[model samples]
Target: MALLVDELMTKQPRPLGRSLILCASALSVALVTGCTSDSGGPSASASSPGQQQKSPSNGSDLTDEKLGKQVEKTLDTAEVSDSDPLFVEAGLERVGDGFHSVPDLTRGHSYKLSVVCVGKGKISLSIAVKNPVRQTLDCDGVTFRQHLTSSAAAIKIDGDGMPGATGMVGWRLDKADK
Candidate 1:
């Protein structure tokens, strides 16, 4: 049995360390802006220390811009530089889901996908490309990244926020380092 298990492991070496690295990066970003329980409002603690706290949405007082800035920083940290010639899409939903599409991608080219979500509830994301990828993010906020080789002309991102989910979601796709 041990030999059989070893054979299987050799056949398919798990990306155990890669997964840990991703989780660590996410946690580090989340730590920068503490997370709070969803109570139908944004918490000042969620804002970066020393910065003016702003709610994601407050009727006349919309704060999506503020969250976008934070997500930008997260993306930059992940090496998805804004200066890069790439497809970038980001936005905030007061409540419910969000969607974005990037067309005219170079098929078969390697690309890096970076995503970050901040706010409340669970944000389920579906990246539809030649090879569809799905991920669930805690609205508390964190940056997650993945590498993919394009197999389609376009990529669609569908962020389905679980019931009562409210937050900002940002994504970037850039040419991966060879």
Candidate 2:
């Protein structure tokens, strides 16, 4: 009877020890996940004290009215004559890595492509045709223009922004007489 009683005591302790370990494991997991969870924490755009914060577009600066005005201004500044007609006037909204393509371009014609950002951010534009090219522009209300010697089937404009940035870009394409 003593032996039986001793055995029962020892087995009870084993289960109790297992239960303690299980509880500890569960607690550890909870702690780890709780720290990593996204509960409205500071995002990548957050900057430290005394650090210059970059102004990245968040899609609010380029409203429809604003974008339309910008496009009209750019076209006017481009001075498209009767010989050169406007091909495309577009507004692009980009977040992170985004692209816009200008389709149905004619070959062997002189073309001008212009882009400007309507908000606070930097936009990088690129042309993809027979040869690929790249350009970076600031959103300080300046228009960037590029002249194309040959017609391309499409012109690809790529927008690169900072982490968690959503910006608006306006573009115009003019076709020159052959």
Candidate 3:
């Protein structure tokens, strides 16, 4: 009986030890994930003592309304004549969320594209269907313009925000006459 008891005790330790290790690993993963995950929402604007608080691009706090207005103002600033055929698309998005505008463009045609953003961090702009043209724009409430000839049957404009970026992003794409 003593021999049987000793054998059972020895056999129990392996499974018991493995269960403990698995539990510990799961707990560690849960803790780490909880500590590092973002809530995907706007954070409160607060500053610690003696820390300089930076203002947003439009001389005001960032909001969906403000972002829309900024984009509208940017689109209006384009130099398109009133009678020219124009295609425009704009949006207000989170800083890290990407935005895109896909428009059917004539092949071998000329057009002017204007993009703008008001927020923190840099936005990556990519244009064209194949072999896309890419550029980075600083989110400083400034409009960027580019003129290009269409190489594909359609044009796609994408803006991606960099990691750990804050504030709102806005853009406008104006399809111009040939």
Error of 3 at 142 (Å): 1.1
Best by lDDT: 3
Candidate 3 whole-model C-alpha lDDT, 0 to 1: 0.69
lDDT of 1 by residue, 75-175 (tens): 66434446656544344443254756564567788777777777778778888866688888887667778787777456776677777777677766667
Clashes of each: 0, 1, 0
Which candidate order results from sorting by TM-score in descending order?
1, 3, 2
Candidate 1, poorest ten consecutive residues by summed lDDT: 87-96
Query: C-alpha displacement of 175 in model 1, angstroms?
Result: 1.0
Clashing pairs in 2: 57-166
Error of 1 at 52 (Å): 22
Better of 2 and 3 by TM-score: 3
Sort the candidates on lDDT, descending order: 3, 1, 2
lDDT of 3 by residue, 73-173 (tens): 76674344546556555566666777877766667776677777776788888887556688988888787888867774677778888875555566655
What is each predicted model's overall lDDT from 0 to 1?
0.66, 0.62, 0.69
Segments in model 2 whose C-alpha atoms lie over 4 Å from true places: 1-68, 76-89, 92-99, 151-154, 164-167
Error of 1 at 16 (Å): 87
